[model samples]
Each structure stands twice: as C-alpha cells, then as structure tokens.
Target: MGSSLSTPGASNANDRPAVAATLPPAGCPMHRKLEDATANVSPPPSAETNIDPRNNIPSLSQNPAYGQTIALPLERMRSSIPRTLSDLSTASEHESASTCPMARGGPSRTTEETKDTWVYPSPQQFYNALVRKGWETPVQAIPVMVDIHNWMNEAVWQEVLRWERRYFNPKQSNLALEPEEIPEVSLARFQGRPQDLSPKARFHMLLGRIFPNVYSELPPFDRHDWMVRRDGWGAEEQDKLHRYVIDYYSGADDEDGNPVFHFDVRPAIDDLDSLTARLQEWARIKRETWLGEEQSSITKDAKINN
Candidate 1:
C-alpha cells in the first residue's frame, strides 16, 4: 500500500551473506570481528553516497495503478528511510563466507535457498559490495547502509509476493485472509547482469520520456534479475525457472529526512501464461480503481441534480 519499503513496518534493501535458517543471537565470533573492525577503523566522514535523484512531490495515499496502456507486468512497493543496524536485534550467527568479518541481520523468506534462507549481509559485506562496485564508501557508515540495503531486498520480495498472489491464490478472493496460500518468493540466487538493462526498464525509459508527466519516475538505481522456481505447478509450469525483474528507485527524502525508495518488481514474460497474467493483473487493478472513482462521481452527480 505504501510507496516504499522504508514505510512504517517495512525493511530496507539489497542482498548479503547466506547462513543457516535460524541465526544465533550474541556471542558470535563473527559478530565480534565486525565490532572490532568498526572500533579500529578511523574511516572517512560518513555521507549518503550512491544517491539517485528522487521526486520531491508528495506520494499518493495508495499505490498507483498502471493504466491500460502500460502492458508490462509490474507491482511496486515503497520503503521509508532505513533505521540504524543497532535498532535491529544484536543477534549473531555462524561466520559467513566473507573474507572480512561481518554481522548477521534477519533471515530471508524466499522460496529457494542455496544454503538455507540467506541472511541479510552485515556492515562488512555492505562495505565490500560498495568497494567492489568501485564506490569509495565510508566504513563507519556501512552499518546504516547495510540496513538500508537489506531492507530494500525485503521490499522487493514483498512485491514478488503480490505477483505470486495470482499464482498461489488465483481465486483472488479473500487474499488478505489467505496468507498461507502465498508462496515464499525470494532471490534464489543473483543472476549477475547488473550492467544489462532489462526490457521492462528500457520500455520505462522510452515511455517515460515520451510522456514525462505520466511516467516521470527516475531510472532504477539498480536492476536485478532473480531466478525463482515454482515446483508445485503442473508439468508445463513446474520447475520452470521464472526470472523476476527488480528495479530499485531512490526517491526524495521523507519528512523524517530519510531517503524514500521504491522497487518495481514483476516476473518477466517468459511464457504465455505469465504474459497473460501480467496484463490481467493490470486490468484487474485498473478496473477496480476506476470503478471506485466512477461510483463516487455518479453519487456526486445525483446529489447535484437533486
């Protein structure tokens, strides 16, 4: 409902280390290592780097519906500014594969787990990701950045859940009540083509420029194609690798002075069924939204006539 993952009760973004499903809290050797690094390092001044321009305009009260013209299959979720890592549980866990020490955040709920549900990365991993990308980030700010990164991933997965609703709960009846029906959709593994622009993204760029007012959103800060598996569906659909597109967009800071971010998440139209579902989902939402508006207009007209 909210535009960004930073919204109240939502988590921040990005992928990190993988560990066992249940992580231990405190007394973790890895946790201590991370703390030691933080204390020892007299890092550069912390600043919000790697930022993208966001719209200063106020966000809509509810999620915006992509009208009939936009045929792409996409669902969006917003996150409010990220909280500090300390605000999270101090829990620690087994050492991750990072050469550098790092702490563990929450466990992921994605359907696929190469080595159990991957835990969000610690400050160390966050730092590594930035440096690996050639961004000169301050070590002192890694903790906060990690929290934001990890929370963004959580937000992206939430959008995946909205798409899975069609697969898991085709009935579209009582979706709010049927939490168990929705499948856990998480990043099975990163496909690693960050440089390549997805088809959906290219279309967004072309269309956005053509109609600046209608599609004026900024280009995604990052794009990830997640390979997910659906084993329960029938033979044709079963075990098929469905690639999902996640477009991360950073928005203007919220009233709290924390950056607002949005993820445009949806499944690629790899197959006929998926393509149909994408259009169907958009039509469903558009119709529902338009119906409400129409009903309100009719009521107002009647009152005015009276």
Candidate 2:
C-alpha cells in the first residue's frame, strides 16, 4: 500500500508539482503566498499617475510662498520704468528719423553726430557768467536763468563768495567800504558812454569794482576794440551786455597763451527790476490764490461745523 501511495500517478508527494529551485523555503508561507498573489496581479500604476499633493497646491517656484505676486502686463511693465525729458527727446528723435522718407535708413552716424551737437550750455558756466556780470543776489531768485544754465561752479562760487565776503560783508578784512556805502553805480555808464572811457579802463573801473580778480586777469582791455563798440542797441540791452562779456572772453588768450576767458556776470544782474517785479507779482498772485482757496476751504469747514 505504501509503495502504491509513493507512485507518480497515485495520491502521494511525487504526484504534486515540484517547487522551482528559485522558490522561497516552505517555512515562509506568508511570503510564498504574497509572491503567488502578486505573480498574477499587475503592479499598481507607477507613482507618476498618482498626483502629488505639492502639484495640487501651487509650487513656491510658480507662486511665491510669501508676499503678493504682482501680475503686471507687458504695457504696464513698459510704463513702470520712468522716462525723462532726455529719454522722450531721444525716442522722438528716433521716431522722427524712422518716419521721415528722407531718413529712410534711420539716422546715419553723421546725422547722429549732428543731433549730439545740440547740447545745452553748462550751468556752472552760465552761473559764472552771471556772477561776473554783477548780479549780486542769491541763486533762488532766477529760476528761468538757472534753468537755462547749470548751478554755479564750486570754484567759481567760492570765488564769488570770497568777493561777496570781501566787498558786501561789513565784517570781513580787506573790505574798503560797507555794503551800503558802495555807491549804486548806474548801468547807464555802459549804455550811455561807450566811447568816453577806453573799454579796458571802463571794464577795469566797473567790473574791477565787481570782480577784482577777473578784471585783474583780463588782457590789457585795449586789445579788445569791438567789445566796446555800441553800434547795435536794442530792447535787449541786457542781452547785448551778456554778449559783450561772452564774446570778449570767448577767444580769451591767457598769459601762457592757453584759453582762459570764461567769466560771465551780466546775466546775473539781468532784468533786475523786471525780475523783482515779476517775483513780487508772483508772490502776490500766489498769496491771493492761496487766500481764495483757503477761504473756500474754511467756508466749507464752517458749514460742516454749523
């Protein structure tokens, strides 16, 4: 009966299928069961199919973890960068060149160079000229003139202050007379008597009193003839005076033959009465305007109070 049970066809161990050499030991039944269960089942879809919680929640890279994310449009971004008058001018120049049939290929290098030549005068130079011309006042009064030129050069302003301290101030040493004592010489001397005194002498006496260093530094003043000539007088007498100073110094040759004539002072005193009057008028207007506006504001407040 035992021999029959052990036979291949009979109900015996030999009749069962042989376990593979690679199979786990029979002691690990749970592992064997798991392997058998999984052998037929497809693997759970890869982790890629499972949406990450981070993906559902906005990523810090896409949406910042802290602070508001501003969504500026292209137009708004372009507008945000502030433009200056110079930038606007450059853009206009480019636009003009692009639009004009004559400038079909855009501005040539030469054209660009020409455009570059249109530079405004230096403020320091303008202020220096004004100081030289005997406009003895603070810089605050002349915004239009200041706008035309730059601020006074530091060296020039220092020199101007020195002169102001020397002549205008009562306390400073080397001051010949009090500010009140220095006679208010009329502008008529230059306007009226162009031929009586030599240009050098007139400049020496007049400008010398104003800018001692400048008068002392100038060429013997006799070498300059056209500078004193008063053939073309006009309403812009002040302008003429400015031109005289500018032109005389324009080709100024120094003691060492290097160009040195760069002092301007007349524009400093230009339109003094007019400027004073205008400033006064501006103050009055501003005061009246403010008062009117204030009255309306106060009236509204009073009505609300009542």
For model 2, the superposed segments whose C-alpha errors exceed 4 Å read: 1-155, 174-248, 252-260, 264-306
**Backbone-clash count (model 1):** 23
Model 2 agreement with the true structure over 172-195: per-residue lDDT tens digits: 434355645432211111111212
TM-score of each: 0.55, 0.17
Error of 2 at 299 (Å): 59
Which one wins on lDDT?
A: 1
lDDT per model, in order?
0.39, 0.23
lDDT (10s digit) by residue, model 1, range 1-306: 222211111112211111111111111111223323333333432353321111111111111122212222111222221211222222223323221112222343234322234444344443443433334344454444444454545545645555666444444532353556544343333433445776766766676678765554355556666666543345554445677766555544444454444455667788886676667655554454456433212111110000
| Residue 174, model 1, lDDT | 26
